[model samples]
Target: MANSLHDTYLTGLKNAHALEAQAIQLLSRQLERIENYPDHAMMIRTHLAESEAQQKRLEAILERHGTSHSMLKDFMTSLSGNLAALAHAPMQDEILKNTFANYAFEHFEIAAYRSLIALAEEAGDSQAIPLLRESLAEEEKTAEMIGAVIEKTTLEYARREAAGQTAGI
Candidate 1:
């Protein structure tokens, strides 16, 4: 017999976990692509190293849960390909795009880690807690990095805009 809505509990949490896995995979590759982009002054190499470790951890987590990596692989392929295609963008456009993309990706990662932490706690997956915490810390760092760039770039643009306004009027 098919299960009714009332018969299921914690269904959303499962979906959330699945989404987290996929988001992490996508973000890892996207960050890797940007790490190689010129003019990116952040410590992306170090982050990429950590990201590789984190990806292995995710693989372990999925394997432990008997889940396939197909979904995450698909998502990562699309996301990384899209980011790579922007490699030739003009400096200004690329900077803005990278900043915005990183910001959004960090938010997604933060949310993903938070969800994983909560789910692990609720499900008594104590071993997964540390993994989620480490991931959360990295996501926070990523957010800070993006904010630093956005602040500097936005200020410079704002100054130029103000200067142009004064010159016109």
Candidate 2:
């Protein structure tokens, strides 16, 4: 039973690692398109670096357990994130859409880290708790930042629309 619990915990870490990699790709694409919104672009760029560091931390955790991340899952998630970002590229409210998606994704990551922390505790993996907690805190902060900006982005979109600065459709 303990072995099974450890395996589950490892799986959770791998999933979180893959999701962070996907976030890197997602944020990179969004950053490229958010040139119109310098604040948003800078925040995304900063988070992209954070995501990379988080991935490294996850790799360290998995290495200590004698396992590694799932390459196939990472590839699939990265592709999906990139595609999702592109889907909003031509839309008039691309910034708003990206902000909403980013907020949701950050929350998803926070939940994953929280679950991983619980699993680590159950498995008596004291070494993993701090690492997981760090990532969880970062995810929560990013989610809060995105949430705080949503209203501003929405208002900016309205202003742009009124001024005929946005795309027609």
Candidate 3:
């Protein structure tokens, strides 16, 4: 039973790691095409860097537990994120779509980290708590930031539409 609980905790950490990698890919794709929304692009670029750091933290945690990330899962998730971003790239509502998607993704990450923290506590992995909490804070901050961006983007889009200008680049 102890071994099974530990295994579950490690699996959760691995999934979080893969999700962060997927976030990086998604942000990268959106950043490339967010020329019209400089603020939004900047926020995503910053979060991209944070996501990379969070991935490293997860790697360290997994290594401490004598496990490693699932490379296959990471690759598949990254590919899926890129494809999803690409699908919205050429659309007139790309900004709106991407902003909404980012907001949703951040919440997903927050939930994953929250679950990992709970799992770590159950497994008596005290050392993992601080790292998981730090990542959780970052995810929460990004989610809040994205929420603001969504509001700003919506207003800006409305204004542009009213002026007969394209709302997306």
On lDDT, the leading prediction is 3
Better structure of 1 and 2 per TM-score = 2
Worst 10 residues of 3 by lDDT: 160-169
Compose the digit string of candidate 1's lDDT tens values, residues 1-169.
Answer: 1233211213323434444444444444445455323334344445556555666666666666665345564466456535543452434344456567657866876886787677667666677779778878987987787777776666544565576632100
Candidate 3 per-residue lDDT over residues 22-101, each given as its tens digit: 99999999888877778887898899999999999999999998889999989999999899899997888888988888
> In candidate 1, which residue pairs get closer than 3 Å at backbone N, Cα or C atoms, i.e. clash?
none
Candidate 2 residue lDDT tens string, 87-149 = 988887788888888999999999899999999999998998998898888889889888988
Give the least accurate 10-residue stretch of model 1, judged by summed lDDT.
1-10
Residue pair clashes in candidate 3: none
What's the CA RMSD of model 1 in angstroms? 7.0
- Candidate 1: clashing residue pairs, number: 0
Give candidate 1's TM-score.
0.62
Model 3 Cα shift for residue 169 (angstroms): 3.9
What's the TM-score of every candidate structure? Answer: 0.62, 0.96, 0.96
Ranking by TM-score: 3, 2, 1
Clashes of each: 0, 0, 0
Evaluated against the true structure, the overall lDDT of model 1 is 0.56
